[model samples]
Target: MTSPQAAPLANAGPALHAPLLASAQIVFAQVSINFGAALAKGLFVSLAPEQVAALRSGIAALLLLALVRPWRRRAAFSRRDIGWCALYGLALGGMNLMMYAAFERIAIGIACAIEICGPLAVVLLTTRRPRDFAWLALAIGGLVLLMPWPGRAHASDPVGIALALGAAACWALYIMLGRRAARVGAPNAVAIGMVAACLVTVPAGLARGLPALDAPVLALAATVAVLSSALPYVLEMRAMGQLPSRVVGLISSAGPATAALIGFVVLGEALGPWQWLAIAVLVTASAGCSLGTAPPVSKLREEPLT
Candidate 1:
């Protein structure tokens, strides 16, 4: 999300590994994330979106706790570090909530497209190149193509839209805070953040979905955590370790397309031919900005803070 922790891993590029395996890992991680999104949708009928989000973080936290055992480790940070970790955790939880909430109200593709506005803003603001603005225009045009005029009779929920955008903003914050956390040697920040998210979400989830957590439902919900939270997080982290941050972020633009595919297969969500074209347009815009731009030498210094 914050361009994958770049600095420490930038030097650990694919040249040190097999290119084919590295490429495969990236694709696999991206696909796993998409599959996770579908699984989350599947849980919606029996669980509220908030509950699904909470259970996901809770289960993921437990699994990570078992594996990483952060509690058994020595204190890696000074007291000053608590602020960054808390901020990062809060942003992480917020992002998770808003994203799931967006999925509840809109198709995954459109919701992701809208949420992407945040990272796109990050890219735009960081650079002064006029050519990059073309990417902005392209993104805008794609958005226009996908979103028809909303009338009083045909209006999508504004609240959902706002939530998605808010998620995007949180994602940006997550990136910044995540970087700080990485710096403080909290290598398990993702897991810890999941635990933090669980702390907040699990209670609310119980209130809303306790009665529904029968054996089958609990199993399915755990499966959702594995698919949506654990697998993708691991895969993304692994892939990010190999790829450059900018390349990784650009490739992640595929999320919407992946979500669209998952939406079609799992949710029976469909779009007109024009929407497909729009997807292509957005992909191209993202790719153009990502690929055409030269990698900065300074990128070698970019690392995750968490």
Candidate 2:
């Protein structure tokens, strides 16, 4: 018999179900986030990226507070768990801040393509399976096609590109940390982390986007928070409980493609044939992963939120 931890690697037992569900939840989570971000981007055109991030995090914090009331269960966590949660929250905040910064300088699709590196790295690092490398290669090749691999003759902001990649690294870290935190319970860990992210973003937004956070913008930001963070977080937690991590990670590779679609449909962006092909590669890889697994049996167990 396999140890419970090893169970997730192979289709060992009922535990394999959790990773499978986690995979599906990951798709739902990324799609929801991309769509919500698209909506928020329009509403936040007048606002600075910092301001928008602040509003998103602040609103998410309030919703999480209302939902989990972390203070009410503080005694439940050990000091080590508390430390891990805090680190997780900080990573979350940093990732968001950096991603918004990236978006400010590049096209949304381009920025997302850069950010994809984070999770892809995670997938590469953990697996020794040769078959999985094909997916990894597909993801990388797709990213190369999506990125402005053109020389200096036609380049965007290098700093912005760097920031987007940084966000990707933080994203990968966030996933790893989130999985650890999920072991501490998704809702509680997320709530605690949001509080930390809130601390990081709210102040920065206030400092940078004070004028933009007035009534109308505040309302828009609130909506963005609900759409981009709270709702997705809730749904993802539910989905993760029923999915597997490998499947979840694989599905999440579709994030860039979803972001591209959101940009096209909502933001009037267009894609060429090669770009569309890249999207196809990513989506097919992700969907193939999901299809390979069966539906999970339960919705109560917590799953990965990355």
Candidate 3:
């Protein structure tokens, strides 16, 4: 028979390891997403960016629908709940479409660096902390470093920059709307939102005309759907359920750096010293803001999908 002290220690083992496991899940999700982005960029050689976005969103929706089978809970959601999920999906669709468009004209790493400003802005706007100004300033400094000054040796296309900013705005909206939709349960909200995303992306892609669909292309597109959307979404949802939002943000702050590394390894895209510095600054700013502003774990509400 175990002593009382021994019993508590035994129970603590799983509790203590839970956060570490969740953190690993988050990191893996980030890697999967960036790697998928690099693969999608390769497809741009044969498919338009919108077409690729459509394929990613459409396939992801189907996979999620099959996995979640959200229809069992269909009667539970009110019309308002669905509206929130739809709005969230629209933002998701817009974010992907714009990011892919930007990727066409710029390096994936640089595009991600610019795109992250959206979530940073969301944090700043929602919290009234005085110290948030510092994060904002850091973000600005990073952007300034990345800007296309007349004498700069390398400059991203201005149009690409604009599209990335658009993606950032959509990301901000996604975070806000996702919170509202979360009350409906994550799996249900995500599955429905993915369907809504299909409504936005598929039509735009269809406008470009269908590409020749061979087995390899279909397989590649499915891989992108799994890595970039389906797998990452599932992993992140599970991790977020177990981990604090602050920890999630901190782990996710490495996104730009991860994208850069993947871009270099997969696409042979290289950045200059200053660009690297800019990404570092942005990462620091995002992590700091997330640490300072994320609500305490006790305050977080977890809703079951049932």
* Top candidate, metric lDDT: 3
Model 2: which ten-residue window has the lowest total lDDT?
Answer: 297-306
Overall lDDT per candidate, in order of appearance: 0.68, 0.69, 0.84
Model 2 over residues 1-306: C-alpha lDDT tens digits?
788887667755656666656565666778778877776677657888877887788788889889888778777778888778878888888888888887777556666766766655665566566655776677667666656666523344678878988887887777788767766687888888887887677777788845534688778778788878887777776765464544554556567778878888988767677667766775554444333333331111122232
Rank by TM-score, highest first. Answer: 3, 1, 2
What ordering of candidates by lDDT runs from best to worst?
A: 3, 2, 1
TM-score of candidate 1 versus the correct structure, residues matched by position: 0.82
Question: Model 3: per-residue lDDT, tens digit, 108-167?
Answer: 999999888988887776767788888899999999988888877767788998999999
Score residue 89 of candidate 2 by CA lDDT. 88
What TM-scores do the predictions have? 0.82, 0.77, 0.93
Q: 286 in model 2: Cα distance from truth in Å?
A: 5.5
lDDT preference between candidates 1 and 2, better one: 2
lDDT of 1 by residue, 80-197 (tens): 5656666777777777778888888877776676666655666676777888888889888987766655542323456776787798787777766766766655446665666766
Cα miss at 153, model 2 (Å)?
Answer: 11
Query: Which regions of candidate 1 fall more than 4 Å away from where they truly are?
Result: 1-17, 148-157, 203-211, 292-306
